[model samples]
Target: MGREFIEIFEEWALDYDKSVMGEHPQYVDVFANYDAILNQVVQQSLGTVLEFGVGTGNLSNKLLNAGHNVIGIEPSEAMRNIASRKLPSMTILDGDFINYPYISVQIETIASTYAFHHLSDIEKEIAIKKFASVLPRKGRIVFGDTMFKTEADKQLEIEKALDKGFTDLADDLNREYYPTLDIMKNAFEKHHFDVSFKQMNDFVWVITADKK
Candidate 1:
């Protein structure tokens, strides 16, 4: 399933940026706050940064322009190639964030956007713990992605989708375990990171976890 998603990104690479930024009504409502959310993430970040799932280098480009050294990890060759062209001097690793061998000494902060939802619920918890393992004290993990407050919150969204005749989307949301803000906070705290949540909009949020 993961490979299948990566393949989809490979095919979508050419138009990925425009597709994401375009004013599609279904997405525009949530994505409208995209830059503002990222701006908050950048404000919290410090020193050298590692970005997982750095698609097309949008956030990375912003971070670089903000004068931060950024290393990126992207799974799709096509996506990585585009990001490389956009950020010619920065190192963009070709690998999966869940399996990537992250070096604590090298990374000062880790950030991701609109990508972490690809993980299963169990995988998300494990990944956060793994991130905590490598993060130096005071290092932060900031990510903005589609998230909910609880299963009830997700169900409400699903109901709205169904009302709007997006049956397929509703079904997909049912199958995907998008984490709640509280769930993620507990996961980070379990791994000894102080965590906070900022809802960027209705469906997407930014989570910051600082290693203790």
Candidate 2:
């Protein structure tokens, strides 16, 4: 199922950058805040970092400029190809989170922005376990994505998005699994992660966890 979704994303890769990258008006500021949060998490200079779901190399470029050795794992070949072209110096892998190649490497930090919510609950749990298994002790995992405040809040947001042409009804239908922050925190905690969360905006939040 995940593989199928990746294939679809790969097929859409040509237009993905134009469609997704920096399309939102607040994207730059949002990412800037995320960079600040990430800077706080690393504390010192960073070592090797793995960016799961490095879509279009947008955040990848930022991480590279921050002096981190970054390996970006992206499921879509189209997206990977785009990232490779943009970030020729960095390593880009066309692989899924559940089956990436470099299991032996002890990653110091892992980051996924706006991508983790695509996973199902079961797959997310598996991926979290895998992340914990490969990370060094005290390694950090930073993830950011949208979270609904309540079922009513979600419905209202979807309605507003449709009315404002912010998103299509089809897109809203596909996004049936955007979990709340509390749910995400519990999931991470179950995998022995000491988690902290901050609401970044009306629709988005960031979660940073350290392997316990």
Candidate 3:
């Protein structure tokens, strides 16, 4: 579970929308093309969507506007509240990637954005397996988050952030579970998902995994 960062999210909740809009200097690259990134995930989704880490409901709103029934799971109460305010009629539950409720309903696509890196590698593998168990054939896991092409590339990014005097960015890079593409690919493929990666910006990548 990525609940370790609940406190951080609680504090960041008020300013999250602004941060995503590129108001913050450090996170500009991290959230480049924010709307477009959410749109990409929205486009891939089908039928009912189970969204994990529904931070502030930005992606959730997109899904709902596209006419998909959206079930949101966010661990932070503050986040859940903001998302609820955004979409009042919808229910945004308290849960995470590895631990979330799925009512007796057909979930055709699972989606997340800017949040999966909170889970450790093992946790990610477990979450993917859980998705494999729940999603039907031709179902998808469309996630747009920060993923490095290689371990060396990840290190270079951290170093670049440090050189730019963005110690917080570097610290985030070191602290969280930002992994290489190879690792993510293995996790999904092992669980029988046909995965593809599309780099959205200098930082984020959209990973679309379809259940075989």
Candidate 4:
């Protein structure tokens, strides 16, 4: 399943930026807000920062422009290829977040966008624990993704898409999970992180957690 998803996303990566990255004004606004939120949460100049699922280095470029050393972990080779071509200075690693190899270098801040929802419940929990284990005492995590109001609502969207016969290449991509806000907050709390949430849109939520 994972391999299939990666293959689909790898193909999507070919035109992801031109097709989806800047196509939505709302998404751009949300990213701007998220960047401000991250600046405020870190409370000091950022040092070493790690971004999981840093597809195409869009946000990674923004972080670098803000004067931080950025390391990116991406699962899709196609995405990494785009990122490398776009931002050669970034240290990009190819691996899933659940099993990415990292050195003992302590990360002061971490951020992810539009990626956490792809993780399974157990995978999310383990990933949160792994992040906590490597972060310093005051480290922070900024995560945001598409969120559903309810299972019924999500089903309705799926049904609508299917009815429209919207058989895009993305339809072939495997999305293993879509966690509720409660589930995400609880998972972070379980790892000793103070959590807060903000609504970015009707279908998206931004969460920031700080290590306690």
- Best-fitting candidate, measured by TM-score? 3
Residue 90 lDDT in candidate 2: 88
lDDT against true structure, model 4: 0.71
Per-residue lDDT tens digits for candidate 4, residues 1-212, read: 13436876787797667544345342343244554444443333257888888888777887787888888889999899899999987889977667787656768888877677777878889989998988889888887676666677656655555565644412522244777777888899999999887776555576878899
Query: How many residue pairs clash per model?
Result: 0, 0, 0, 0
Candidate 4's TM-score reads 0.81
- After TM-score superposition, the amount by which residue 154's alpha carbon in candidate 4 deviates from its true location, in angstroms, is 2.5
- Rank by TM-score (best first): 3, 1, 2, 4
Tell me the TM-score of model 2: 0.82
- TM-score per prediction, in order, is 0.91, 0.82, 0.98, 0.81
Error of 2 at 82 (Å): 0.7
lDDT agreement of model 2 with the native: 0.71
lDDT of 2 by residue, 54-132 (tens): 8788777877877888888898878888889999988888677687876456688888776776777778888998888
lDDT of each: 0.81, 0.71, 0.93, 0.71
**True lDDT of residue 113, candidate 1:** 88
- Candidate 3 yields a Cα-based lDDT of 0.93
Alpha carbon deviation, residue 11, candidate 2 (Å): 4.5
Query: Would you list the clashing residue pairs of candidate 2?
Result: none
Candidate 3 lands at a TM-score of 0.98
Give the RMSD in angstroms, all C-alphas superposed, for model 2. 3.4
**Sliding window of 10 residues with minimal summed lDDT for model 2:** 23-32
Scored against the true structure, residue 118 in model 2 reaches a CA lDDT of 73
